[model samples]
Target chain A: MGKVKIKKKETRIDMTAMSDVTVLLLTFFMLTSTFLQKEPVTVITPPSVSEEKVPDSNLLSILVSPEGKVFLEVLGSKDSTMKSETVRADLLKNMVAEYKKTHPSANLAFTNKEMETFSKLNAFGVPITKMKEWLNLEPDLRDKFLESEQNPGIPINMNEDPNNPNEFQMWVRAAYNSMNPELQESMVKGRGIAIKADQTTPYSVVNVVMDNLQTMKMNKFTLMTALKTSED
Target chain B: MAIKSKSRQKKFDTRIDFTPMVDMNMLLITFFMLCTTMIKSQTLQIALPTNEKVEKEQQNKVKQSEAVTIIIDGKIDEKTGLSNPEDGMLYYYEGMPETDRLAQGESNMEQVEFGDKDGLYPAIRGILMKKNEEVVKRIADLKKEWKEMKFSKDEEKNDSIYQEKAKAIRNDSTLKRPVVIIKATPNASYAHVVSVLDEMQINNISRYQIDRINDVDSAMMIMVKAKNEKK
Candidate 1:
């Protein structure tokens, strides 16, 4: 048999199809997802059958830690006209004015630079007295101090009298009276204010917050919850 | 000889190895998938009564026959100071609190368990469903129609119509619907309170409010707990 010898070919796979699929998947993930915001504490909200989605903008979300610390996160109108930064800057100015009304003798003023920094923050809970000091710290240190056990958050308590408001109440008032009229409207309608607390938090801590809101006459609000998988 | 001088043309393979590109894309996809949050948080809306003290006479009194009070209590873990959702107690009473009968170790307040995981609170569900039977019956009928798309050909239109009809049925004052007042003790887990609130929605109840736990309520609870222990 005078036949030519058979040559073996390299078993190389064409990855073009795989590359195409991965690129499509990456595009989908980029388009369909939102980046997670870093918060001082992580909380697993209780599940409920309510299907109402949390509003994207013009919302004032109050985050309650298991230790009873309260933090506030504000969102402005969805459009670029009234960005969160502008609203937050205005809110800080109003808060300064509010703090002075309660403690008129105390001199508290935030510089333009400090206001800018405050506007960039997604959530804040330090006491108004320590706000300037907290703002002055490096970003990493500020976050550490916020999550630390020693940091007393926003000084909340069961104060029913709205005449002599607490720091937390003052913050609420400031947020309500901010430059964004849309936020004020939603706040009045009960859509703007949302309480996000861990499922394990004692009812008393949440009650204090509710009582405080009641005193302010901002009784209508939303409780943020995760969707329950099993619906009745 | 000139014909024999035709040059041999060399061919080159044009296929590209896309392995490197796919590897880079996979790394990016992993990063994005980890960093992104696809599921948005849901919200439950609630409206608490104003804190302003109204004149007792001006207050619209609830009919004792239609009033149902639910109080949520839970066991707190001493070590962590956290309320265990799994180990929870629910006490409910019909009509007004009978403080006079408490001395005789007899009260209208009855204790109920939150139920085990599989049942998903069958006890409380039964009680609430029994209370809102009229509305529940009507809503169930409407839901059947809604499932069949009897309201309209368009799915969205059918849904809106069903929702509107169900809401009307729930708020129908002609039916006997219980006015539930939900109260939670300080030691109760927040989840328990939410679960109770969720029960209100599931029961098709339109009139319910979250009220503060009062002294009379606590006295009754203590009496009932003592009674339960004795039993």
Candidate 2:
């Protein structure tokens, strides 16, 4: 049987132009786009109404990787650590201490639980209980202990603490005795903290963190936020 | 007349020309693409503690007593909400992941306030644990300083170490509940922050705040509790 070779002449699809266009598009996106792949923390921060323009470099960056590990910029680009609390604490303590000498009345302290008066605590905006935990140290006879402190407090000796788990009143007495005079003379002058949170972070995280910071007599505070990106 | 009209009649073409529609579509697409590249969104959530505005007088006194500064940085969500160190409910203390959140610290009679029941805490145990470690380290440092100082020295000098230690104890700044600074990225999640606060319960430290960097300076957001009512 003879075959009818009807349409082989005009259907030669020259995909050269298409291939060139694809390559061009790929290159364009790659060059013009910023893929922050190094971000390891995975969070969904709420929206903010702040409008601050911050520089990318020359600033201390506390990166929250998608996996939730903090990638701290301790000194500079040369030395950064993630998922290491020891390193972070060391660097932060040292830096803050240095900052404190120059700025004595700096709000650089975190708040404590149960201020010996307040009974409740909140995490984020929610109320998470730590009071019972604090009370655990107080024996069942808390009333008796309070009475003892009122009757005749323990001597201000190093070995006698009033805030210890077993003997809180005694630990409190010793803790007071351990105070340094010069710092006390200054009356714990004013200080502050600089916080930089990520965009995808949640509201509760900031709230709880704020609660922690309130303890150190660092009452004054300023919040930082990035200007929102425009959809225009 | 009818036969002559046949030559004058016009014939219409039925093929649709999509050139104008295509042009309009391309223009709209280009406009959207270009405009979208102009700015990016800053999606971050913040939960300021709900409390009666503090009196100016107390605020001033608190400001004057700038002893230790603490900061907590993290995000919040359903999972990482409400960190009660006093709560006994399993759900109440269940914090988010431990990577984020913080708690309170300590201070002196003059430097400290009586209540912060409205204060927040670590939702995650990990952050709280780290905070405890830092506080212990600070105490150790104070001990070392105490050891280094001469107890039998001149009055002014001998009293200095004691003063410093008293300040440290009074100005307890731990992340869990001592003096510590926290800087959370906005990208961190709610669960992450809550887990950190949960640790505050595990550790007995208290008093802290969330650190904020406003412009060229450092700032903070805090939780304040109502003063105890004298019944």
Instruction: Give the alpha carbon lDDT tens digit for every residue of A132-188 in model 1.
Output: 999999999999999999899989999988889999999999999999999999999
Q: Chain B TM-score of all predictions, in order?
A: 0.92, 0.23
Model 2 off-target regions past 4 Å? A1-8, A49-54, A63-232, B1-231
Report per-candidate DockQ.
0.84, 0.05
Supply candidate 1's per-residue lDDT for B178.
Answer: 92
Cα lDDT tens digits for candidate 2, A1-232: 8997787584444544544555565556545653332222333332233333332222223333222222223111123322222322333334334445545686654233323222221100101122233334454343343223222221111221212211212121121122222212222221112234443345344443344323322333333333423221
> Could you give candidate 1's per-residue lDDT for residues B28-85 as a string of tens digits?
9999999998888999999988754541222248788788999999888888877777
Least accurate stretch of 10 residues (summed lDDT) in model 1 chain B?
A: B51-60
Q: Rate the local accuracy (lDDT) of all candidates.
A: 0.90, 0.33
Name the regions of candidate 1 deviating beyond 4 angstroms.
A1-7, B1-12, B52-60
TM-score, one value per model: 0.96, 0.26
